[model samples]
Each structure stands twice: as structure tokens, then as C-alpha cells.
Target: MLKRTISMTAAGAALVVAAVAGCGSNVQPIQVKLAAAEVLTQAARKTAQVTSYTVDAVVNVKHPQQGGGKMQGRMVYQSQPQLAADLTLDTVDMAGRSLPGGARAVLQGDTLYVKVSALQDLLGSSKPWIKVPLTEQGGSTEVRQLLDQIQRFDLGNMTQLVTASQDVKAVGTESVNGEDATHYSGTFPVDVAVQQLPADRQEQARKGLAEMEDVAFDIWVAADGLPRKLAMNGSKQGATLDATLLFKDFNKAVSIEAPPADQVGELPQSAPTN
Candidate 1:
């Protein structure tokens, strides 16, 4: 009887130990918020090191009454030698009417060449490609302003926004573009974010953010410390805008050349009225 009792007690203790070991194996590492911020900063630094990259973006716009529009586009940016882009606005729609065809833009050496489906009729030119220098004198004030805004859309500028945001925090880990990535989110005040910019850039950043109430960003950084995906949301004058970007082929060599001179045409002397 004594032997049996001792055997039973030993078995009970062994079972308890096994259960404790099982729980230990299932424990997850605690994530500190500060640690997450550090991770994001590191990731942003890594992204800034890249000289060139490609982005795929889908944009949705919603208005109170005029209806909304959707745009899908791809952009390639190369920083070395000079800033350049080969971009195609693959599809666009507004008020349920689809644009006739894809719109394209190319930037090379302070000049931007654009081909817009809607402008084809207005310009009355079969060449379709309109070349405008990036100077105030080349196009209307509004057109020049729009071109300036587009020129600032790049990954390095965006990473500055992330680093300067006070509300940035890590959300968690998730799969982005089929790779495991750490997620971070933040809301940034336009004025505050602008203040973080260099003196030379603050004015431009302020101008861009003036129309936005606030910008919300969500970025996913892959294990290699590079951003794999990013989303931005903002509202202005009762209209809501959302944009998503997928980054790939970092530091990859891309060939982008100016459109053939024969295929390019100058913007009409008479600018279209708004």
C-alpha cells in the first residue's frame, strides 16, 4: 500500500511538470512599444539607402456630391545622376466615365512629358505627348504647381514623414507581398510634420499639407528592414482620399529615357482654363 501511494504521487508531480513545460513552449515574446519605434526608424533608414525603386499604387477618391474617381498607376524612381521617373497612370475614372486610355508621365532633366486621354481632344494634336519644362514660365501657374507637387512624391520624402510623426507605433507583424513584415501606424498633423523638415523643404511640405486635415499612415517593413507596403489616408474639404503603395525591386537598375523627340509635342500656347 505504501509503495503504491508513493508511485501515485510521483506520477502526479510528473504530469504537472509536463503541463508547465507545455505552457512555456507556447509563450510569445512581449513586444515593447519603444522597441517597435526603433524598428521603424531602422527600416526607414534602410529605405533611404536605396537609390532606386518601383512602386505600384492604387488610389481612391471620394467626394460629397461630384462623385469620385479611381486611379491605378506604377512609378519608377532613380536618384543617381539625376531625379527621373517613368510613370503610367494605367487607368482612371470619374463620375462612372472611364478615361479613354492610360495616361503616362516621364520626368527627365527638369522637364516633364505627359500624355493624357482627356487632353487629346483639347490639344487637337495627334502626337499626344505634351512636354513642359519644370519652370513657372513653361506652363500656367496651376499646371506648374501641379507638376511641382508630383515631383515631390518619392519614398525618401515619405520616410521623412514617418520619422517625424509623433504618433507612430507598432501594430504587429503581418504578411506583406508574401513576406513577413512588421506593421507600424501613425497619424500626423500637417503643420507638425512640416516643422520636422529641413528649412529648405518646410515651405514646400507646408504647401502640400495645407489642404489636408491630417494624414494617417500604415507601413509594413519586411525582415530585410525595407518597406514592403504603405497606406495613406487623408481628408480635405469633405472629400476622402486613400492610397496604397507596394514597393519592390529595391536598388534595381531601371532604364528610363526621354520619349523620342518626334513623339513628343509642346503644350499648347493657350493653356486650358479650369
Candidate 2:
């Protein structure tokens, strides 16, 4: 084995809460596929009822070049009714290599920092550091970008965009770890092609009929009415990456506090990517 590594570092920087992109996998339509785009949209609107919850995510990532691995992380999702969620992904890993070690990703509200240098053998010495430009733009580059992403997570609003869809279905019920899950399927709309991909890559994906075709997913929402397992297949037809998020162990007491002002890194007069 070449000690393979699949990094969520970009996700850490881009804050990809919706889903991961660039992973290669096959896709196909399902039987009894319901155009329940409106249902999801309605459910998202009701996100207000969900205030606090912890998530233990097991992300099995697969890319064309980078094989695959089951990554685990804990998330704390909080909200003020209609407001966006204050989310956090504690640890993300793949093939044994943990990127953003001792990482603490905060959404909007207060932020948390787990000194990577002080952490145990959770990371490597040569890991790539995120080079985010810091300006006199008030908050830290990390903080500002994080909050913006959270705000954009207007689930209720975005669900509205699920107007029409295809190849949708219900994969009955399955066991994720131990919890019961109901699976649903759907394809991504062409209108949102740019949303799931980078601008340049979006153009490439659009050259063929694949542009109009929707990306399919077998979303396993837990019986508890929350998203628990998500099997995001690729553009072709087989399983690309599998993600099972365990919501059972989620405890509310996961303490969250903002870093001290002194501990805060100075907004670069022109700081380097550390």
C-alpha cells in the first residue's frame, strides 16, 4: 500500500456541508422514483424545529485517482429557529491519514480551536496548510467564510429549487450501523450544475448530454426524520462514495466557546497561509 491519503482539507476550507464533489461514480434512475422535490423542500422549511443535535458521520470517500476510505467526524448543529445552522465537524479522516488534525470547524456563531501542534499523532508533519488571504475585513478569513457558508445553508430556501427531478426512488429501509434508515433518490438539476462543481469543471461536465442529466443520490434519512445515511453515486451508475452519519451518540453537552481574543491570529496586514 502506498499509504494513500484522501483529504477533506478542501471541504474544510470550502465548508462543503451540502455534499462533496469531484468523486467519480456511476449513476442510474430508480423504480418508483417520486418527484418529491417539494417534500424535501417542505421538510427543510421545518428545520426550525430542529435546534440542537450531534452527528457522528462515517464518510466513505471514493475518487477516480484516490481509492477510498471511511472517514469519521462529529458535528454539532445548532440553530435559532429560522436562522441557519451553526455546524462543526471535529475530525475528518481517510485511509488512516487525518487532514486538518485537531481541527474545529465552526459555522456562524462562536468558533473553537484545537491546537493541531499540541494534538497527538493524529496528523503528519508535512500536511498542507490552507492559504487563505486575510484582509482588514473585520473577522478572521476562516471565521468570515465560515459564517457566510452557514448563512447560505438556507435549506428551506434551497429546497424550493428542487422543482423538477428524475430517477427518484425509495430504497425501502436499511440498517446504518444499528439505526434504521429510509432511503430516497433524486438527480441534480442542470440549473445547479455550477453549484455542485467548480466553474471550470462545470463547463467540462456540460459538454455532453451529462449536462442535462441530474446527479443521483440514495439519501437515507433516519426514522427520526433527520438525514442519517447518504449514498451519493457518481454520474455513470455505481456507488462512488458512501456516507453514514450516526445521529444516535449525539450529545448536547459538547461544549463550544469562542477562542480568546489573544489567541486569535491577527488579520494579516498580510499574513501567510499557515
Candidate 3:
């Protein structure tokens, strides 16, 4: 039960980040101002030229009354010929006790694989991996619904935010992770950011962020133009969520593959999917 709770919460966090990109309320629009916007413009173009990258991230979450959690993880994301990510979360504390062995989540196209331990003996197999097939291949409707919400969190939203931003000028230089970086601050225009989404995705994206207001975000870029850190904070009447992701090792060589066939099992109909 605890595992299920943690997994679902992680999925929910992804959905929230998607909503924060856009969707309005008492939230005013952002114009993507000229001065600061140019900085982001350059950064965006530089990032677009890269192939793959690694992110060493630390994220904190807060809910209205339920408290929150902390997660320290690393992600290897590839976008050249294809899109995929391999993630290893070393620490997760979701309002309760910290997760024992942390967790692993891999995303390849529409498929997601999650592993909680080095052994899956709990399911009668020593496999250690639980596969969640986001497609129609297999999975219950409920499971699919929850996983579907996380689909928009591809980390590419940084591009959209930069392109749509108005005022994000340099604040000062700060050391991010270990490298020197230029810190920039601005209030991201939720409406403008949402408009950047593809037509088919616009409505859903707006709906997801409909209840949010007072959005603020910042990003740190290195001398080479690569963003070292991205942080966003948003809140509504009773709830608030803050998220941050750090990027490193640009053009990192990585190969993302599913867990070994013999060491993976389908997600139980009881959980989410597979």
C-alpha cells in the first residue's frame, strides 16, 4: 500500500508540473519581454542543438494540508533520434517514512517501467521490475488514467517556457551544483506558455492548470549557455507546489533499454498499468 501511494504521488507531481506550464486563473498573462527574453531565446536554441543530457535533481513538494515529500534523483534524457529517459531516484520521503530502496522509472515513448527493489519475489518472481505499458497493450482503465496525466512531463517544456517568457533577466552569478551559473528570475506567463502547446494539447493543458495562480519560475544557465537548473513555484487558494530540475553532462552518451525480459513483470491490474 505504501509503495502504491508513493508511486501515485510521483505520477501526480508530473501532472502538476504540466499544469504549471500554463492554464490560468487570477493569473495574469506573460508577454515574453524583450531584454530577458533574448537570454532565454539564446539558451533555448543552444539546448535544441544538443543530443542527450543528464540531470541531477532535487525536488520538494507541498500540498495544502497533507504535508509533502523530498526526492533526490538523476535522469538521463535523450532527444536526438528519439525520446527516452532513464531515472534513478536515490531518496524519496513522501510525508511518511522514507522509501527503503528508492525507485527507478524509465520512460520510452509511451511505455513506463518502474522498479522498486532488486528482487520482485513479492510477485512470485525474482524479476525486480514492474512494467507499465501505457499503450493499449495491457493495463486497467484506472491505471492508464493516472499514468496518462504524467505524459506531458517530457522536460521539453523548458523550451516552451523560454520561448514564451517575457522578463527573466540576470539576477547574479551563483554556483549551481558545482559550476558557476547566471541566475535569472521572472514570473512565467501561464497563459502564454500554454498557448505554445500543440493545438490538440492546449485544452487539456489549460484544464490541468486551471486552478493555479501566482506563478513564479527561475533558471540558471552556465557560461556555455546550457541551463543548469530550473525551478518553478505555483499556488492557488489552498495548495502550493514547488518543483526544480537540474541539468548537467550535456550531449551525454546514454542508451535506454527496458529491463531484461526475464527480470520484468507486468504491473498488476490492481496498481496502475502494464
Question: If scored against the real structure, what TM-score would every candidate get?
Answer: 0.76, 0.54, 0.74
Q: Considering summed lDDT, which 10 consecutive residues are worst modelled in model 1? A: 16-25
Q: How do the residues 199-249 of candidate 3 rate in per-residue lDDT, one tens digit apiece?
A: 766565544443455458888877776677888777766666576776776
lDDT of 2 by residue, 160-211 (tens): 2232345556657788767776666776665564445335444433321123
Model 2 alpha-carbon miss at residue 28, Å: 32
Ranking of models by lDDT: 1, 3, 2
What lDDT would candidate 3 get against the real structure?
Answer: 0.61
Each model's lDDT: 0.61, 0.40, 0.61
Runs with alpha carbons beyond 4 Å of true place in candidate 1: 1-34, 65-67, 94-98, 203-210, 271-274
> How high is the lDDT of residue 18 in model 2?
36
Residue lDDT tens for model 1, 4-55: 2212222221111110110001112233444656766666556656767777
Candidate 3, number of clashes: 3
Clashing pairs in 3: 32-165, 32-166, 33-166
Clashes of each: 0, 8, 3
